[model samples]
Target: MHSMRLKDKIVVITGASSGIGAITAQMLSKRGAIPILIARSEDKLKETASGIQGRFGMYTCDVRDSARVEETFAEILHAYGRIDILLNNAGYGKFADFTEMPSEEFQDMMDVNYMGIVRCTKAVVPHMLERGSGQIVNVASMAGKIGSSRAVAYTASKHAVLGFTNALRQELRKSGVVISAVNPGPIATDFFKIADPTGTYVKNVAKMMMTPEHVSEQIIKTMEKSKEEMDLPGLAAFGIRLYGLFPRLADKLTYNVMNKK
Candidate 1:
């Protein structure tokens, strides 16, 4: 297999402690990239960094803290010299009906899923601009493209993420900076087992889920090539495109045929 070796490249990944971020950190490090794992849990971050085969480090910061984010970015540059990539993967999902969902939960999702990238991107872009090159990959989801009943806030936040990536990519077009989005379908990770452990939320899609390693591979590929947008698992990508073209038809198919419980 051809290695997309990011040798000597410094990549920062938020939410690097687990799920796609964790797997991506390990995969990139194996391929010669220096990954900086960012998450609130210092212990988990330490574990992830220690297990990496290449140079890996951790930053414990809540992405909601703008001042802390700025400080941390400076610390990274001081240590690594330059940051070549950023994977804003820190996020959470709260599945609940629109009217029944708590207001604070909605705000929290917006803060982390939406504002998290905003704060981190704001911190890293300037340095990239000065260096004349960098890449920011926002981890969005299929929820960004379609409406799911129980994930109103999460869906809205992801849609915002996709929109943000498009707009920012345009603004940075001439700056040698590339900003993109990646939407992944269900993946087998501790997240699902935790958030939807009762299997109430995940039981239905377990059969269709991809492994963390598989999703990580896709993420690294997109990052290496500077892909504008990527949809992991070609099948889901095509399905989403078809759904985009025919919303009502897709909804009917999904609701009636699939029973996407």
Candidate 2:
């Protein structure tokens, strides 16, 4: 299939206040796409919009709030007439032992990481279906593909995201609405401050962290190419595939690698 051009495309990005979403909005704007930024921070959204060169819109809506998500999408549709792309990127993670973690924290992770994507996708998909041409990209994580120590809830939420994306893709196979997932490893962002408050995980994985710009670039390319999924960092992708084929052996190998100093 011929890749779609970015110029003049109406792109909606959730979690646009910071990290990958912010960088993606800037990049998309530079490529001549009209990026509509969404986040819970109205101030931060405005700040992001200020840096962009072309026309853009900012909406303050927490993705976990279905009513707010619906309203926000409705507003965007009223203003822009159509949505060409929807990037479901709003999510957070907490790294802790499952036994030590609180039930509330687990619920929060599921709400933001999994249901957030669900609400946003539900709101925007009908519009895409009506037009018969649109793109939906869910920002999942490598943890979704493989289990990791100290991230049970986080991993579970991401796993849910991957499953949801795959199922939706199959359901929309002939709907002209493309669906894809981007599974990135640790990113160099403030997310670590929230996920790993002690700074241990971030420091250990610092060397392997990819910049938000790098991930954003791949995501934009995926949007154009309509690739089914992407696992950032070639080594991580290899590990994930290996785990899929040989879970027992891969588990032992992963333990050894992760334990290496």
The candidate maximizing TM-score is: 2
Candidate 2 RMSD computed on C-alpha atoms after optimal superposition onto the true structure:
2.2
By lDDT, who's the top model here?
2
lDDT of 1: 0.86
lDDT of model 2, residue 184: 95
lDDT (Cα, tens digit) per residue for candidate 2, span 41-153: 99999888888999898999998888999999999999999999999999998877889889999899999999999999999899899999999999999889887777889
Alpha carbon deviation, residue 185, candidate 1 (Å):
0.9
RMSD of each: 1.6, 2.2
lDDT of 1 at 142: 82
Q: How do the predictions measure up, each by TM-score?
A: 0.95, 0.96
Off by over 4 Å in 1: 256-261
Sliding window of 10 residues with minimal summed lDDT for model 1? 252-261
